[model samples]
Target: MGAVLAKSSSFLFILAAGYLLKRFGVFGKKDYAVLSKVVLNLTLPAAVITNFAAMEWSAQLLLIPVLAFLLNWLMMGVGLLASRRQAAPTRALFVLNCPGYNIGAFALPFVQSFLGPQAVVGACLFDVGNAIMCTGGSYAFTSAWLRAGGQRLSVRDAARRLFSSVPFDTYLAMLVLVVAGVAIPQGAVDFISPIAAANPFVAMLMVGMMFEVDLKPGYLRQMGLVLALRLGSAVLLAVAMYQLLPFSLPIRQVLAVMVFAPASVIAPAFTVKCGGDAGLAGCLNSLTILAGILGMLCTILVLGVA
Candidate 1:
């Protein structure tokens, strides 16, 4: 128990350092945009390639992506339901709020530490699934909403837009790396290792940057409904699935705990780029991430792992 708390504290501290750096104006707005591009286009993809390239493919692994989509969709449903009785901003918050673990940086290493090497493969699968759902599913949802508001996107145009996105490219590169059996040079691997290693720090720092934006107090009160539904649903579903699924205890527990992880930090940014509400998305994203960290710790304790 002390060991787990030690590791968790170390993660939060690094996260706090990033936030403090952002808070003190060590980086300007342009710097964040620059950082975002570099990390999304180069560092993250490289990390995914290095990780996925080493994993052996399996049908069971495919289940991870499918499950990820279902979970996101389920969360989306919760958001939509919440919005039906609320205002538009609130609705946007709910929909944008629904996502599973932040793969690659935040969840991967933590998972690897507890579950060993095999969990890296699960991370890869989860990443692929998340990319598809966040990219493809988000586009579809936005298209519908925009068209209802008198803006329509043709099938070709939507596909072209999605293809041009970085997440799509990252997913494609990871797939190619996994299928082709190519080996990255050790020097190149060394170059990327630090970037990948710095992932969680990047995530927490982004949260701090959002904090600097000075959101309304009422906005947070409004978010309380969403926080409960989204986080609670994830934890409850994870527990139920872990117990009922026909799998080994380890896999069940890991999957359950991971589900409780915060929504992917990148999703709100993606939502903004894809023409969704970036600020509202950021609000939900921040709160969920804060909750996810707590929920995941609880999940780990429940699983009886030290």
Candidate 2:
């Protein structure tokens, strides 16, 4: 427990550093934009490939894709229904933020600590499907919502729009490399390991920077409701899956608790790219991170990893 908290604190510290860097203009917005692109496209995909390569898949791992999609869809439904009485922008944030969980970095570290190296393999399998959903699902939802709101639409433009925004294709390419049994040269893995280590740190720093932005308190107020819904839904789903799913109890517990993890740190960037409100999205993203810390702690206390 002490170790988990220490690691989590390290993550938050890196996030704070990113915030300070941005605020001081040490890394200009243009620099952040470029750095983010490199991390998402190049570093992230390499990390995914390396991690997934470490796994030995089974029928269970194959179901992970479907489960990830369903979990996101279900949570999106909860967000949409909850925010129906609110405005489009609010709903957009709600839907866009639903599929988020920094499973690769946040949950994986803790799971590895509690459940051992094997948990790392399970998490990579889970994250592959998650990466696909993040790329495809977020694109489809954001593009469709924007179009319906009288925003301009073009299939080619949308395709290009989606491709340019995130690292899904890169992640997919890495997954293909692993699935096809291609060796990732030793030099490449060593090179990217530092970047992979930096992923969460970079995200946290970006969050701290976002905290410096000025916004109405009313807009920030809704974050409480958002946190409640997100955590509640995850806990409920975890309990249900544990009791009902045919998978091993350990896997069910891991997935359920993971659902309670924070909104993906990358969500604000995605929302901003899609012409959504970046600041509001950032606010929600921060609140979820704070709230998720509690949820994850609770899950760990109760479940005590296999």
Candidate 3:
């Protein structure tokens, strides 16, 4: 418990530093886009390539992505049902914010520290599905639903977006290498190592740069409802995986930590693109990061090094 709390505090301190930087104009709002691009295009994909390139292959490993995809769809359904009575924009934002865990930035470090290399591979695999959802899947779904009355959602456009995403492309390349028993060259891995190491810091900094808390009555109510459902689903899913899944302890641990991960960092971007409320989405994203950190701390304490 002490160790977990210490790590949690260290993580939060980094977050607070970023927040302070942003607050003091060390990082302007527009500067966030620059940091975000670096994270998405460089560090994040580098992290994925480095992790997945070294993963040991197994049929059981395939279950991670499938579980990730299913969990995302389940939350989307819950969000849809919960916001059914809301306006189109709010409903779309609610649903968009529901799925897609922040696996790469927020969850990976903890998994790597506690569970070791093989478990990190499982978490990376799960993040493959999440990358797809965060990159294009949620946007496509929301756009289709929002335009159900008129024009059709452009499947081709969505596919193009997904393929063009740096993280998704890296995931595909790594998976193919894994399938063919091809190893990334030692030189290439070494080259990416330093950049990959920057991923967690860049991710947290971006979150802090974009952080905002809106206490307006209507927004507060809506955010509370959505967060409640999101965290509740995470708890239920984590409990089920821990108790009933036949996987090894490490795999179960990865699954549980992932469930408690916050909403994707890309969610607010998608919300803006879908004509939803970017401010609200950003608020939710920031709050959930804090919530997820606290939640994972409790989880580690409860589960211990199982």
Candidate 4:
């Protein structure tokens, strides 16, 4: 328990450090965009490749994507129902904010630290579906919902968006190598290993830099409702998985942690694209990160794993 607490504290401390640095003008908000690109295009992809390369392939692992997709759709339904009475743009933001999880940047570090390589692989595989939702599913849903007449999204366009994600592309490449019994050259692995190691710190720092809170009229109430519905669904799902699933401990643990992952950072951008309030979305995203950290810490303690 002490170890888990220490680990959680260390992660939070780094996050605080980043926030403080930004507050002090050591790094400006503009710098965060550069840093985000670094994490997304470079460090994150390297980390995905490194971890996936090290994993043992299994046919049973196919379940991860299926589970991930189902969970996201379920939450999308919750979000849509929760905001059905809102105006179109606000409704789009509410629904957009609910489904995607910040698995790669937020959940990966904890899973890697507390679980093992197998769990890392499980988390990464689950992220395959998540990346799809983050990049394309949310946008498509919002567009259809907000259109005067509901419209279907182009499947090809969505696929193009999904395939263009660097981390997702890396996942595909690594999976191919794993299935073909190909090994990454030790020299190349050595090159990537250090960059991969930077993922957790860079990711946490990005979250801290992006953190903000807003207390405008009715904003708190809306944020509270969205969070309540999201977290409530997570609790029910966690209970069901624990009591009913036939999976092993590690798989259950990975899913449990993932259930509480923060809203995707791309959410605010998507909200803006849908003509919603980006500031409110950003605030909600930040708060979810804060809440997710606490929720995951509790989850770890309850599971009695460090």
Best prediction by TM-score: 4
- For candidate 4, write residues 194-246 as lDDT tens digits: 99888888888887887878767767888888788778887888777766766
Which scores higher on TM-score, 2 or 3? 3
Q: Could you tally the backbone clashes for each prediction? A: 0, 3, 0, 0
Tens digit per residue, CA lDDT, model 3, 95-190: 888788988667876665556666777788888777767767777787787652223347686677778777777777887788888888889999
Which residue pairs come into collision in candidate 4? none
Cα error, residue 52 of model 1, in Å, equals 2.9
User: Can you rank all candidates by lDDT, best first?
Assistant: 4, 3, 2, 1
Better of 3 and 4 by TM-score: 4
Give Cα-based local distance difference scores for all models: 0.63, 0.64, 0.78, 0.81
Query: What TM-score do all the candidates reach, one by one?
Result: 0.78, 0.74, 0.89, 0.92
- Candidate 3 backbone overlaps, count: 0
Q: What's the lDDT for residue 171 in model 1?
A: 62
lDDT of 4 at 301: 88
Question: Which residue pairs clash within candidate 3?
Answer: none
Using alpha carbons, what is the TM-score of model 4? 0.92
Candidate 2 lDDT over 1-306, as tens digits, reads 676567667766776787778778787754555655655665555556556555554455567657876788777787778878766666767777876677754565455445543345555556655755465466467657643243444556545644664445554565566567777787877777776555555544544554444456866666667777887888788788767877765567677677877787667766665566767777788677667767876786677552
Q: How would you encode candidate 1's per-residue C-alpha lDDT over 141-247 as one tens digit per residue?
A: 74465332224445675577557766457666666655566665767766777766555455445445544333667566656787788777876888787888665
Q: Clash number for model 2?
A: 3
Candidate 1 stretches greater than 4 Å from native? 53-56, 87-89, 112-114, 142-195, 201-207, 210-215, 246-251, 264-280, 304-306
- Candidate 3 minimal-lDDT segment of 10 residues: 146-155
TM-score ranking of the models: 4, 3, 1, 2
